[model samples]
Target: MRIHILGICGTFMGGVALIARELGHHVTGSDLNIYPPMSDALAASGIPVRLGYEPKNIDPKTDLVIIGNGIARHNPCVDYVLNQGMDYISGSQWMCENVLRHQHVLAVSGTHGKTTTTALLTWILETAGLTPGYLIGGVPKDFKETSRLGAGKYFVIEADEYDTAFFDKRSKFLHYRPRTLIMNNIEYDHADIFPDIEAIKKQFQYLLRCVPSNGSVIFPNSDTNIQDVLSRGCWSTQMATGDESGWYAKLLTPDGGAWECYFKGEKRALIKWHLVGNHNVQNALAAIAAADSIGVAMHDIEKAFATFSNVKRRLEIRGCVNEVTVYDDFAHHPTAIATTIDGLRKKVGEQRIIAIAQLGSNSMRMGAHGDALSFSFQAADQVHVLRPEDKSWDVAAVLKPLGNKAFVHDSVADIIDVVSKAALKHDHVLIMSNKGFDGIHERLLDKLSV
Candidate 1:
């Protein structure tokens, strides 16, 4: 089968293209923002990717058209597909029908930590010799690529709550009926699509309805929002992290690398690794419960936890120049920003945390978080907000409550200048952004090195 994918540069769509190629289909794709390393990955997989959407890129002989959520009505290729009555399905729908249908899917879904948790669970399954297939949004350092078709019956997916496509208004996770679902805490996000928290919650309720009675819904017990979502109705078995009865974790190390895991109050095994923070600890617990539910031994999970490498851009250290370390993170939400900073704070106590955050996400850029953004950065010694050149939110005014602790910059150059001058030895320069902050991490490193 020859499949043409529209908007294939996106992480999810790119992964889907790879999966299609691996599944023996000749896959070709096109996107307006066709850049590496997704483009490089597609090229390596022998899939030709056109730069932009046009009616010609649709491939007249194409067997099926997989439209990415990023594609909308104005796209010439989309218009052609609709006008010609070409068979089309969303990227998520294609995966559900072609790939996931044959496998036991384990989906990691939530507003935050989906990529990290998905990577962790996939590693756990791989370590247990399950050889699980996986589709992750970001490139996992453990597995150099984003998606693969494995020999095992298990498939691990990073389930996103975002709409599947312009035509399909439902959350992408709805199409993925996973046997094991990890709801890793939910909060209001994606201000462009969702009007309120309840609107997002309603979508979550639909996701819960898809799970079979034999399946299990894994989540952190501490989240009231998740508790509210489940209250509506949950037919599947429920597992909770941070609770004594279900599945819980006890932090041992000060850096939060070692955890004592218990299921039903019985000591399962001690998981020790290099990942930091209580959020990661919760992620580990969710993975542990999900893996154990599928019959993976606790000791095997311990081995996987010991060797699990984090996903790229999730607290990934870009470099250390002159004793000033620069870290990259995909933390755009208020909760994620707070957790990432708190995690780093645990690692480097008393060291000046120069938090360089980009309000790139729609929610953050629209000033939806308002004063909470200031509170999210209270843990950092100083917060540097790289105001998006396209969006005007008056971050300085939004962060007025923080006074001099917060500084807003109009350009990346200004941020680099300020950080280059202010960053000192032993300072942890944490750069947080969902998208590339105009390559600030490396540019900052070069400046600091000079």
Candidate 2:
């Protein structure tokens, strides 16, 4: 089938494009902003891509339009497709019919850990010699690809609860029709979309509604937010664990670098993943439960986790020079930042942790919860707020409470200068942002390399 993807540059949609292309489908996409690494990845896959989205980009040859969640009804091409009554569905819906309708869909959904968990699931399956097809929001560094259309019978996906698209008001995961749903955690997010935490929980309820009776759920036992939803009643089989519960991770120290965690549970020491932090522990436990259900032995699962490199930009060490290590992470939320910091603190003990974050995500830039930015930076010895004058949010007001931990900076150069002046040798400068922050990591690396 010939597939045209709207908003193809988005991480999720881009993976769809790559996987579709690998499946021998004619894949083409249009996005207003097109650049590496997404553009580079798409072009390298030999997929035809249109520079900008317009109604003219669509025609009779297009069999399906994979509308990305990022593209709204107001988008010219989306608006045109809607007006013409064309055959179009969301990325999630399209995946439901084409990629997962008959396969074992291992769906990982949560306010956190979805990407890491999905990647962990894929890695265990791969290391255990199962070539699983997968679509992840973040590119798994080990595979170097976000989507792989392999011959594996299993399909792994990071099941997000965000609304599918403008046409479909339900969360994207609803259309996924998951056979196994890994409910990690849930909380308030996407302020512009859902009105309250309960409103978002309702979407989760709907996702749970779609799980077939034979399917199961894996969740953190200690999360009160998760408990609130689980109390509502679920007929599907379930597996529960917390950081300190039945299935848990014991952090194992490795060499000078890297983190190893042991996944011990009632039946086995299922897995020991190389990823760090409590969040990753939950990620491994969730993946372990899914793997156990699929017949991957506990010990082999542990070996897979022992060597599993994390997804790219998720606590990825970009460079180290003059004893200062720079890391790039895709953590934009407060909880995510805190967890990432905790992980780094353990790995690079006693080093001053310098964190630089950008208010770049739609949720961050929307200004609805600007104050939360302060809480996100509490772990950094010194914090740099990129694009604080983002025009959408009151940056100064948000940083006011943080006092010394936060500082508003316009460019990457400014951040480098502050770090050089204040941070001592062996310090860890961590850069966190979902969107590429003006290629800030490389620029910082170049400055640090000198």
Candidate 3:
């Protein structure tokens, strides 16, 4: 089938395009922002990408139009699809109807760690020679790609709770039927769409309902948020979170990047992971449980864990100069930021934990999480918030309570200048945002070099 993807520049959409292209479909796409590496990625695949949505781009001969959730009712192409009555469907719906039916899908869903956990789970299966097909939200460093449409009975995907499309407002994951579900912890996110934390939780419950009785859910142990949703109903579920959890994880060496995790407090898997958070320990466990359910041996999982390359931008090192290391993470939510800090603290110890965070994602930029930003940085030695370029709120008011410990600046360049001037000799500078922060990591690395 010839498939045209709307909003192909998004991370998820770009992944879909590649996967569709792999499926031997004639894939064409259009987006408002058509730039590298998405543009470069598509061009390499011999797929022509158009700029901006136009009715003409719809191509009457196209078999199916895969509209990304980012597209809405008003796009000119979308309007034309409606007016002309073209055959189209949401990306998730398309995947459900064509790709996932009758497949044993190992679905990973949560506000945080979905991409990482999905990558880890897929890695375990792939290492065991399972050759599972997968559609991860982020580019896995191990694979150098996000989506794979291969010949395998198992399909692993990062199940999202966000609305499927402007037309289908239900959570996207409901379209996915999983024989095995991993419910990582949930919280308030995408405030632009969901009104409250509970609203988001309700959607998660809906996702949980999709799992069949034969399928078991591996979830975090101590999370009250997960507890609340599970309390409402019963499902085939298991636990994997804390020190005393059902499926426990043991870290062999506490030294920074290398970790050996034990399930049930007995040595299970050993790996050197770049991710720096206890939250990631839980992420690893979720993968272990999913793999065990799928018949992958513990020995193979341990080997895959050792060789697994981390996901892109989750804690990616952009550049390092002078005496400081400049790192990047897509940690926009307050809870995510706090967990990132906790992981770094475990590694760096008393080294000045310099964090430059941006309120860039939809939720952090305009939610009731003004106070969350302050509490999120309790683990950091110094907190610096990039005064939102979005103008979502009075930046001063939202961050005023942090007082002398926190500083809010209006420009990424200004934040770089401050960090460059005052950072300690061995400080680790963390640049946190869901989107690129005007390439602040590069600027800071350059300044620190001098």
Candidate 4:
């Protein structure tokens, strides 16, 4: 099969390309901006990628076109496909038909932690000798590629709630009929697509409708939003984390690098890992429960957790220069930003923490989280926010609550200059964004090194 993917640089679409290539398909793709680690993975796999969405990029011999959600109507490639009467399908639908249908899919879904939890569950299955096929939204340090066709019946996926494609407005997760579902705490996000939190919940309610009666759904016990969605209807066996009634974690350390796992009031295992944040502890509990439902033993789960390296861009440390460490994190939402900062605060303990953030996600740029954005940076000593190009909201006014602690810049160059000057020994600079942030991490590091 010859396949051409549009918007192929996106993490999810890139994963789909890798899976298709692994299946012996001749796959090629094109995107506006291509960067690692997806670009690196694609190159290593010998899959060719074009620079832009030009109509000429699509090969005449291409048998199918898989469209990414990021690619909207009227893109030259999209119009070319339509005018040429070429067969087309969304990445999610193609994944469902080509791979997920044959495997027992274990899906990790939510506003945050989906990528990490999916990588964790996939590693758990791998350690148990299941060799489960998986598709993670981001690069996992432990895995060679973001997606693979394993030799086992299980397939783990980081299920996203974003719309499938311009043609199909439904959430992408609707197509992944997961047997084991992990609903990591949900919240209002993707404001460009969803009008409100209720709109997001309605999509989750539909996702619940996809889970079978024999499958299991795991979630944090304290999340009322998840509870509200479940109230609508659910046939799957329910497992709640962060409480005594279901899976729980007793944090042995404040940073969450070590913890004791519990299941229904009994000790299951002691998990000591390098990952931080209470959110990750909750993610681990959910992964444990889902793994248990599939008959993976507690000891094996403990072993897997011990060796879990975590996915890239989730509080991943990029480098340490002159005793000042720089971390890269994929935290765009206010809730996620708060949790990530809180975790690092606990880890560093009174050390000067500098946060360089970008309002990169559409929701942030549209002011969906503006009210709570200022509060999310309380833990950081200094907060520098890269002003969005949209200019729909006043980034400076939104972060005004932080007073002198916050600084808003119109360009990545300005942010890099300010942060590089402010950083000192023992300062932990956490750069938060969903996009590349114009390669600020390396540029800032270079400035600091000089």
Candidate with maximal TM-score: 4
Per-residue lDDT of candidate 4, residues 45-92 (tens digit): 989999998999999889999999999898989999999999999999
**What residue runs in model 2 are displaced by over 4 Å at the alpha carbon?**
83-85, 243-245, 252-267, 270-273, 370-372, 389-393
Estimate the TM-score for candidate 2. 0.92
lDDT of candidates 1 onward, in order = 0.90, 0.80, 0.82, 0.93
* Ten contiguous residues minimizing lDDT sum, candidate 3: 249-258
Order the candidates by lDDT, highest first.
4, 1, 3, 2
- Minimum summed lDDT over a 10-residue window in model 2 is located at 254-263
Model 1 ranges with Cα > 4 A deviation: 389-392
Which candidate model has the greater TM-score, 2 or 3? 3
Leading candidate by lDDT = 4
Candidate 1 residue-wise lDDT at 250: 79
Candidate 1 residue-pair clash tally = 0
Model 1 lDDT per residue over 45-158, tens place:
888988778788777998899999978878889899988988999999998998888788999999988999999999999999999999999989899689998898999999
Q: What TM-score against the true fold does each predicted structure earn? A: 0.98, 0.92, 0.94, 0.98
RMSD of each: 1.2, 2.7, 2.0, 1.0
For residues 1-450, could you state the per-residue lDDT of candidate 2 as single tens digits?
888999898889999899888778999899887877788889889876787876888765788888998887678997787777778888888788778888888899999888988988998899888898899888777786788876777899888888888878888888777788898889677877888789988888777778878988888888888888878877798787665444665444521133333334334673444566767776777888888878998778878877888888888889888788889999877788888988887776766899888866667777756656677677678888776555855687787887867787877788877766766688888889888788888888787777
Q: So what's the TM-score on candidate 1?
A: 0.98
